[model samples]
Target chain A: EAEVAQSPRYKITEKSQAVAFWCDPISGHATLYWYRQILGQGPELLVQFQDESVVDDSQLPKDRFSAERLKGVDSTLKIQPAELGDSAMYLCASSLTGTGVSYEQYFGPGTRLTVT
Target chain B: TQLLEQSPQFLSIQEGENLTVYCNSSSVFSSLQWYRQEPGEGPVLLVTVVTGGEVKKLKRLTFQFGDARKDSSLHITAAQPGDTGLYLCARQGGSNYKLTFGKGTLLTVNP
Candidate 1:
């Protein structure tokens, strides 16, 4: 079966360093999302992209976090000068359309980032 | 902000037992979804309830959407070891494609 793909299943970085994670959504999916999950907590949305345009990023820490889906297929989420508090599982999900009401999201095995 | 709350943060039961997990919110959603996530892996969708008061069944699992679309429930009958995992409920937020997820119910079925 087709599934969302993510890279660097595990990452370890020091404080004040930069880190990046990548995701490739299922074929023909138009909506992509990035989320962060601390241990024992639910995943929280960070950014959302509808094709190549950002539809919701209000939850993203813009000062240090950035995400982009240039071709609307694969996406990259970057954190500049990462902090210890940034250690968490970064998940990527995609849906068939931009409207969440119509389709179910498919998630990829997340990148577990640990900032020391 | 719209938020979903899941009850019974953790559940441990013997095989053949019956259990139910709940998801509630103050905000109504256009649709609600249930997912199961195994350790070190992503969540997999189990069911989606769109209409109010809808009920869907998958094998030994039964899902119900509240009459007001603000709550949902998942019931499992004769649970087995394979049923152990984290159960999450997510809803589509207002006028947005982003999903608001509940903290989730961690279930451990002892065989």
Candidate 2:
């Protein structure tokens, strides 16, 4: 089965350090998403991308967090000066298309971040 | 903000037992999707329910959508150890596909 791909399955960084995660959606998928999952909680959307354009980033912390998909195929999410409260599982998901409805996301094996 | 409230945050059952998890909300949704996640992994899609009062069965598992489209339920019959995982319910809000998720229920099927 085709699946979304994520890099750096695990990460450990200090409070003042920076961290980055990458994701590659399945071929032909036009919609990609980045989410953060705290322990014992469900994943929350951080950003959404439609090809190379951003669709929604209302939940994203723009000040310290940033994401981009240059070619609209692969994406990267970065956090500057990671905080201890930022420790969580970063997940990436992709869908065929995020139009009206009927888009089911396929998630990748997430990257776990632990900030001390 | 759209939110989903899941009941029974945690559950444990012996093998061959039955279990059910619920997701509810005051807000209406166009569709609801269920997912299962194991330790250290992202959630995997289980089923998607659309329309009111819709029921779909997958082998020993059954899913139901509420008539108001604001709630959904998942039932597992004769659950085995493999059924142990965190089950999450979510729905896409707004015009895009940014899914709002419930806290999720962690199920442990003991042998």
Candidate 3:
């Protein structure tokens, strides 16, 4: 089965430094999502992209975080001047269709980020 | 967006024991999903319940969607050590079909 792929399974960074994580969704998937999972907490949506275009980012801290899916296949999430509270698991998910209740998302093995 | 609340935030049981976790919401869901996550890994989709009063079974696990579509439950029969993980309930809504998840129930089945 095809699976979403993420890079740098673990990362450690100093506060005020910059960090980036990458994700490649399963082929043919049009919708991609970025989520942050705090320890013992449910994952929260950071951004959603549809065919290289952003669909929703209201929950994203635009001042410090930015995500892009330039070609609509793979995506990158970046945080400049990372904060200690920013430490969490970064998950990437993809779905074949961008809409509907029937579509289920497939998740990648997330990147674990830690800020010191 | 809808908020999902999962009950029994943490559960520990011996192998062969059974347990149930619940998910509730004030807002109705068009559909709901259950996922399992091991430490250091992303959540993996287990089941999706679309209709109210729907029930689906996967191996030794059973999932039920309430008649009102505002709640769901997962029951594990004869749990095993392999069942140890985080159980999360999720729903998709909004114009973009954004997915929202509950805090999750952490289950540890001791051998």
Candidate 1, residue A95: how far the Cα is off, in Å: 1.6
Best by DockQ: 2
What is the lDDT, from 0 to 100, of the residue B11 in candidate 2? 99
Model 1, B1-111: lDDT tens per residue? 788899999999999999999999998888899999998888889999999999999999999999999999999999999999999998865566567789999999998
Estimate, for each residue in A17-95, the C-alpha lDDT of model 1 and write its tens digit.
9999999999999989999988877889999888999989999999999999999889999999899999999999998
Candidate 1 CAPRI level: medium
Query: Residues A41-79, candidate 2, lDDT per residue (tens digit)?
Result: 999999999999998999999989999999999999999
- Tell me what TM-score chain A of model 1 achieves: 0.96
Error of 2 at B59 (Å): 0.8
Off by over 4 Å in 2: A98-101
Alpha-carbon runs more than 4 Å astray in model 3: A98-102
Candidate 1 clashes between residue pairs 3 or more apart in a chain or in different chains: none
For model 1 chain A, give the 10-residue run with minimal summed lDDT: A96-105
State the TM-score of candidate 1 restricted to chain B.
0.96
lDDT of 3: 0.93
TM-score of 3: 0.96
